[model samples]
Target: MSEVVETTDCTNGTTTTYDVVVEDARIVTPNEVVRGSVAVDDGRIVAVETGEFDADGDTHIDADGRVLMPGLIDLHGDDIEQHLYPRSNAAVDPPMALASADRANISSGITTKFHAIAFEDNPEKDRSPELAMDLVESIRSNDSLLADHRIHARCEITDAPCIDAVEEVLVNDAASLVSVMSHVPGKGQFRNIEKFREYYENDANLSVEEADELIEERISLTEAELSTRIDRIVTAARDSGVVVASHDDETPVEVERLDDRGIDISEYPITLDAAQRARDLGMFTAMGAPNLVRGGSQWGNLATEEAIEEDVADALLADYHPPSLLAAPFVDTGETLSTRVARVTKNPADAVGLTDRGRVKEGARADLILVDPEPTPVVEHALVDGEPVYKAEAPR
Candidate 1:
C-alpha cells in the first residue's frame, strides 16, 4: 500500500502563500490545546501560530474556537464489511461500498481507515473468506477514495487455510496492517461458551446444535497446530515490515505471550489485567470506540471507560462505527481533551508506524479535522493532505 500522495499547488519558500489556512481554532497538539492558525501548503503543515495569518491562502476557514485536531486514524474497523453486505445475503457493489464507507469515515473525521478484512473461515451467507480477501485487494488498489483506505488482514490462526491467505496478502504487499486472531469459543473474547453460542446464533443464524458443532471444531485444533500457524503468520508480517497486532487478548499471561512473540499492539484485550500487561510491556492497547460510546461492550468484556481511567488504553478503533470514533474523544472519559484526542489520532498512527500524518505539528502531513463539540460532536471540515475531502454546509 502507498502512503505518500502527490502534493498539489503547495506553498513555496520564496512565497509564504499557503494553499489553505484555518484561523482561530483550538488546536490539539501532542501535549496541549492552544488557540492558533494553521497554514497548509503542498499537503503539509507549513505554519502554526496564534491568531490569523497575514499571508494569502487559496482558502481560509474560520474554525471559530472549534477543535482543529489531527484527523482520526482508525486502526481496526469492520464497518466496510457492513457496508458491503448490508443484509444477510444481499450485497452492495464493491465500488459503491467503498465510496459509501469512504464518505462515512471522512464525514466522521477519519482520514486513514484500516478496513479489517477477515481471513477466518466463515460459512455464513456472504461471509466467506474468499469475499474478505477480495475486499482486501479491492480496498488496496482503489485510487479514487476519500480516506486513505488500507487493508488490515485479520488472520484467524485457528484456521490454517485462512492463515495462509493472510500470508499471501503480506507477501503480495496488499495489507499494511496484519493481526493474528482466534475467535474460538471458551477463550479470549468468547471465554463464556454460552455467549459464543448467542453470537453465532445471531451472526451466522445457526441453531444451538449447529453452534455446538462449531464449538467442537474450533476447540479441536491441536496446540501444536496453533503454534505453527501463529508463528508462520507473525513471522511473515515481521519479514514484510507490516505492523503486527494481537486481537481479543484474554489474560495477562496471554498478553505476555503475545508481547514475547513481538506483537506491537493488543486490540481489545478482554480483561483489564490483559490490557495492563500489554501497556506494561510497552505495546499499545486498543479498544473499540463504540464500546466507550455505548457505555459498555456489547459482549461482556473490559469496559473502555475503565480501561482509559486505569491508563491502560492507548488508542481507540472505530471497530464498526465511524461516528463513535469521532465522538469518542469527547465522551467524558475523565481525561484531558488532548490526552483523549491522541487515542484516536497520534497513538494509532504511531502504532502503525504512521508518525508523520497523525499529529498537528509543523512539517507533518496536513490531515486534519475541525469539529463542533457542544450539543454533539460533528465534523465541520475534513482534509486529507491539505485538500478538502469533506465539508459540512454552512448553517442557513
Candidate 2:
C-alpha cells in the first residue's frame, strides 16, 4: 500500500515527489472505512485509495492494518489543570504544565486541543483571571508543543472581574473560543444545591456554611449587571471572530438567548429539552465523553449516551480526560462506527470552525492516528500535519 505521486514545486521550479506513504491502513473516514494507504506531500494528504500504488516515497510507515483515522479535535478539555496543580498546594510552572499536557494530548491521539481555562473570581479556588490570562500567553508563545493548542476561555459570568480579562484576551487575539457560563447554586451545573455544596467544600476546602455564604453572595448580583456583562463579552468575542459557546444551558429559553447572541455551540446542556431545543435552533450540541464512559453524568444531569440516542448531541468532548476522546467510540452508542467517531472528530472540528482537518480525505491536513482497538484502544502512531509526533513501541 505504497504510492508514488508527482508534484511541481513552483518556487523551486522543479518537479517533486511524495514524501511519505502510510501503507496498509484501515482508513476511517466520515463516510466509510476502507483498507488503503495514504500519501502525504508537504504536510497534506495527497491521495487515499485502496490497493497498492507503484510509487516511490522518501519514508514508508507500515500501518499494519491498524485503524487510521483523523486525529481528534477536542473542543473542550481541562486536563491541564491536573498537571498544573497536581496537589492542593503544589503548582507546576505554566509552560512545564502545558508541555506535559501537550505530550499527553498527542499520546491520546489529540492533534488539535482547546484547553478550557476557567476565569473565575473565586477566592477559594486558584482559577483566577490572572492565571487564565497567563495560560493564554503561555499557550500562544510556546512553539515547541506537539499538538495545535488553543485557548477556550470558560468565562464565569458571575465573575465580574473576568469580563475585562475576557475582553483583553479577545483584543489580544489570544483565545480562539469563548464560552459564557454561570455556575450559581440555583442554576446551570449547580442546580442541585447539595451537590454544589459538596463540590465547593471538596475543591476549595470550605465549610458548608462558607459555601452557602459564597453562593448567596454570587447570586446577589443584579440580573441587569450580569446581562450587561454577558452581552459585552459575547459582543467582543464575536467581533474578534472567536467561536462562541454556551455552557450548561438548562432550558429552551437559555438556548434561545444564547442563539440570539450568536453562540455557535451549546456545551453540556443539562436537560434533554435544552439539548433538543439547542439543536432545533441550529446550534451544535456537545456532551462530555466521560459521561458516556461512566454511564451517567457525575452531577445527575442528562446522560451523554441518552443525548446521542435522542439525536440531541452533535459532538463529544474530552471534558476532563483526553483519553476519553478515543475511548468513547467503542462504547455502546447504538450508532455506526463512523457516526461515533464523528462525535469526537469531524463534528467537534466543525463546531469549532476548523474545516480542514478531522477526516482522512484527499486535500486535507494530514493529522491522523493509527489505533489498535483490541484488548484496549492504544494510539500506536499519531501524525500532525503528516509528521510523526508520537509513536508507541512494540510491547514486550
Q: Give one digit per residue, the lDDT tens place, for model 2 in 1-396.
A: 235566566667676588777899888888988898988887899989798744446767788888989999999999988888888668899999999999999988999999999998764667899988888889999999989999999999888889999999999888989999888888889887777888999988888889988889887988677778788988998789998898999989978977987888999999999999999999999999999988899888999989998999899999999888889987866677788888888989887778899988999898999899876678988888877779894764
Regions of candidate 2 where Cα sits further than 4 Å from its true position: 1-16
* Candidate 1 lDDT, 286-386, residue by residue in tens: 99999999999988799999998899999999998999999999998667899999999999998889989889899999999999987889999998988
lDDT of 2 at 270: 94
TM-score on alpha carbons, each prediction:
0.94, 0.94
lDDT for model 1, please.
0.87
Q: Write down the RMSD of all candidates, one decimal each.
A: 3.9, 3.8
Angstrom error at residue 173, model 2: 0.7
